[model samples]
Target: MIQVENLHHRFLEIEYLRIGEGHTAIIGPNGSGKTTFLKLCAGIELPERGTVTISGKEPRAVNTGWVGEVPDNNLVFRTVADEVASALRFGRVRADEIKPAACAVLSEMGISHLSSRATHTLSGGEKVLVACAAALALPPEILILDETDTHLDRKAAENLETMIQRRPAPCVLQCTQDMDTASRADRVIYFEHGHPRYIGTPEETFSHLYNTEMYPSLWRIAGCI
Candidate 1:
């Protein structure tokens, strides 16, 4: 379980929030603190006030795998296979065992063909997939994505959506602009000016927003405009 109590940041504030298993998507307009919230949850950034915890531990203390908005930001190796295996190497796994481990991870993610490709040469969609593969190599208890769909094409986004739905992690969270993607999540949190304006199922959240002037683009996407 993940809990946030009296959380406060530069542009974010939450009196209390609880997240129990399953997938949750965070959505808001630009600079509404979507990425900031993910960073806080990923343990990359600490909240200046209140508390954020995962399974009784602080976020930074928990094992987390993150895929950021820019795929290149997550790459640490030249080849796809190398990047996938990098986590194991850092964990001090046996050199002989690393290659097989990386291969297995790629196969599990259904991207074995990318193992031989150069990380820098991969297309936008391929990079996202490779980055996801690398993050999952750790098999973290919680997975966080920060606007990973921003650069993906429709097909790539759908492929990513499928991968996310099948993820083995107990908790998965992502920030996105696509209402269609957000609608598929178990729950959606809509933010306004860095504050959580609403939290509920997609139907409930979007149905409310569709009638308001806050999310014009979302209404158009949902064909409610």
Candidate 2:
């Protein structure tokens, strides 16, 4: 399990508050420190105070994998197949086993046909799928996704939902603007002014946030309210 203790981060006037785990969704308006919080949780950025412990170990200790908000940020290999296979290499899997492992991941993600395609040529949605597949191939103890659903279409989004449902991680933190995604989370966290204003089931959090003026107007515009 992931445990966050008295976490406090600030950049000028912005601050990030403490948070815990269990398939949590972090929802907030832009500039509410959502991405910064994710970066801190993923250990890309250190907390100025407090501690974030994943499985009793720091995030940096586990070779933890992350799927960033921008798909291109995760891209290193030229081909879709190569990108998926990179995770296997990171795990020290043999060269001959890489192809089958990559193929399996691509198939599982419903992108087997695009295995040979260049990563840069794939559409935004396809790249997101590829990045997710890469992150899941090795099955990290914690999976942190930042705004990954924005590029996905309805079908791809459904596929991603299915994939996440089957994830084995005890801690999954997804930062997303999509209510459909948040609605499925075990817990929903609302961040306002860099602090958690609400934390509970999707229905509870959404209902509470909807009635308040602090809720994002886009959620109402999208009919999620």
Candidate 3:
């Protein structure tokens, strides 16, 4: 289990709150420190105080795979195939194994055709798929998804959900404004002013916060407003 102990992060005089994890969903209004908290968990930034542990090991010390907010930021190679292959290469897998591995990953994401295309030329949604494929190729103990659903259309989102469900990991931490995604989570953490105001099942958390039921349609309504 991923455990966060007395975690505290501060920027100048402002303090971003602390939290623990167990199949968590970090939800909050804008500027509630959700992104910052995810960044700390991904070890992209260090917290000022306290500690974050992935299965009893520090995040940096562990082989934690992170898919950042911007998919393009994660791409180092020119082609999508190269980008996905790079992950396997990092693990010292042989050349013959790379194509099959990359093919499987891309096919799972339903983007196999684009594998030969230049990563920089793909659309935002396409880039997210490439980034996700690369992340899955490495299979980390902990997977952190940062607002990946935001760029996806309905069909793409469903495909993404399917892929996420199939990939089993010890810990899955997703930060999203999509209530559809939030409702699927095992537990949800609602943030207000950079602190967890509510932590429970999605139904319980949303019921207390909105004084209404939690449903996929509710998210649609929220999106319209």
Global CA lDDT computed for model 2 = 0.80
What lDDT score goes with residue 109 in model 1? 65
- Which candidate comes out best when scored by lDDT? 1
Q: Give per-residue CA lDDT, model 3, range 52-170, as digits (tens).
A: 76667777887676777887787889999999999899878898998898899899999999988998899999998888888888677777888888888989988977877676656
Badly placed stretches (over 4 Å) of model 1 are 91-97, 212-225
Evaluate all candidate structures by whole-model CA lDDT and list the values in order. Answer: 0.83, 0.80, 0.77
Every model's TM-score: 0.88, 0.87, 0.88
| Superposed model 2: Cα runs more than 4 Å off | 11-21, 212-225
Give residue 132's lDDT in candidate 2 (0 to 100).
Answer: 92
Q: What does the lDDT come to for candidate 1?
A: 0.83
lDDT (Cα, 0-100) at 60 in candidate 2: 86
lDDT of 1 by residue, 1-225 (tens): 889999988878988989888889898888888899889999899999989999989998887889998877878799999899988787688999989988987876678988989999988767888888777776778999888888788876886777666656889998887777777788898988988888887777777787554444645765763
Q: What TM-score should be assigned to candidate 2?
A: 0.87
Superposed Cα deviation of residue 179, candidate 3 (Å): 0.9
Give candidate 1's error at residue 91 in angstroms: 4.6
